[model samples]
Target chain A: MKNLKIDETKYTPEMTFDPETLVIAIKGKSYPENTEEFYKPAFEWLEKNLSDLGKKGLTVNLELIYFNSSSSKALMNFFDMLEESVDNGDNITVNWMYEEDNESILEYGEEFLEDIETLPFNLVPLKSRE
Target chain B: MTDCIFELKNDLNKNGIFFCFSGPISQDLIVEIGDTLKNKMRLEDASKSSMRLVFSIIIEQAQNIIYYSEEKVRPWSAGVNAGSISVGIITVAKKDNSYIITSGNMIKTEHVDKLKEKIEKIKGMGKDELKQYYKSQRKKDPDEDSKGAGLGLIDIARKVSKPLEYNFSSIDETVSFFTVTTVVAEGL
Candidate 1:
């Protein structure tokens, strides 16, 4: 399958799903005009590549600055899909990256981890780039 | 006309309203007004988290109007999926070191009871409960007509420093005017 790379837009995030190194990164703000439509390609790519995952282990990085309620739901669905991979014996790790000073984002990361069973989830804080 | 315009400006200033929009609301307008809100908040020295909270609230409320407002206009477009714009009013104000977000729109009268029940539940929920509810709701499939995950109210509740406030007034036998407000305290 082809790697997925969607450049960031004003109201969406940059999504990079590479099957080669097994590093999936979704970064930037997310409040797309159509949440379901914006996330369609990512979902399709993951569904196609699920079988190829876990051999080398998969790392998912989420570095979102702001996301609307709709995008939040999309993230939950995406994580659910990854958790399913874990159930299939895939070695998957999810790193939720947030700025150090923003406690709200940190709390958000914790919230997303609530339903993630059996996946290696870590909340990683980065220093604010001033 | 000039005096009317001046009076309107004066009223907004008197109420500490920094931003206000009342008309057809679309995705493009949300992006445009959101940028203006951020620039204004930055100039006011809003903290990082506070800015995020304000922006999130604004977007959620605006989208609530966009998705649920009863008053709508179909706009001719070249895209495959035809679009409609909702009509509503959104205002951001400052009072007692707290920022307030207020949104108003019309809703079908039949939906008022259900909306009230949902709002009351959100109003009664503490932060932890709201967070749990938001997560659970996020997991559910969005309704067929829903443009969002149906977690907007809970998400707004989570950010607010107080219980969410709402008002509904009968506009006609078939529709009602609805308004919701959330406040973010100055400190966090």
Candidate 2:
């Protein structure tokens, strides 16, 4: 399947999915007016490609500076999909990256970490991006 | 009318409000407002976390207006297919070392009771409780009438330094004005 690439917008995050490497990177702020619409394509891509992923493993890196509540819900849905894939015996891991000083973002990551049942979710804090 | 402009400015200043906007609200406008507020807070040397809290509150409140506000206007040039923008007012102020964000918009009278009940329940929740509620709500599908995730108010409740404050006033038989305020303590 073709790779998925969405450029960042003022209110949306940059998202890139590499089918060959089975790595997906999402970075930047995400507060799109239509949260569902903004994430629909990625969700579709994952649905279409999940079977092909097999035992190859998938890595998702999420580095969000800020996201509004709706976007938060979208992220939860994204993780839910990943968890379902993991449940189906697909090898999947997620890395939630946040700035060390950003307590709120770190807290959010922690909450998601606590919620996941089986997926390997990591809260990786980077040094302050000064 | 021109003379009243000066009085209006003074009134806002006296109330500690540094930023205020009223009328049609769109997604693009929310981005501009968020950026301007972020820059202003950064200049004041506000901590990153405090800024994030304030910014998040503003986005939640502003987007609520965009989604649920009863008042709306569609630009004639945009044609019929273009969507209408909601009308509302949003303000940011400083008081007692806290940043205050207040937003008001018109809402259908039928929604007043349900909305009031929702806010009252959220206000009664402690931080931990709010966090749990937010997570639970995030897992559910948004209500049919909801334009965004139904978790916006709960998210605002969790980040706020204090309980959410809200009021409803009847505008007529069919609609009422609803206003909600959130506070973020500086130097968090």
* Candidate 1: pairs in clash: none
Question: A-chain TM-score per prediction?
Answer: 0.95, 0.96
Report the C-alpha lDDT of model 2 over A41-127, residue by residue, as the tens digit.
Answer: 999998898757736888899999999999989999988988888888989889999998888889889898888999899999899
- Give lDDT: candidate 1, residue A8: 91
**Top-scoring candidate (TM-score):** 2
Winning candidate number (lDDT): 2
Cα TM-score per model: 0.94, 0.98
Model 1 lDDT tens row, A3-118? 89999988899999988888999999899867988999888888888757765699999999889988888988888888888888888899999989878778888888777877
In candidate 1, position B6 carries an lDDT of: 97
At residue B36, give the lDDT of candidate 2.
96
Question: In candidate 1, which residue ranges exceed 4 Å CA deviation?
Answer: B75-82, B143-145
Models, CA RMSD each: 1.9, 1.0
What alpha-carbon RMSD in Å does predicted model 2 have with respect to the real structure?
A: 1.0
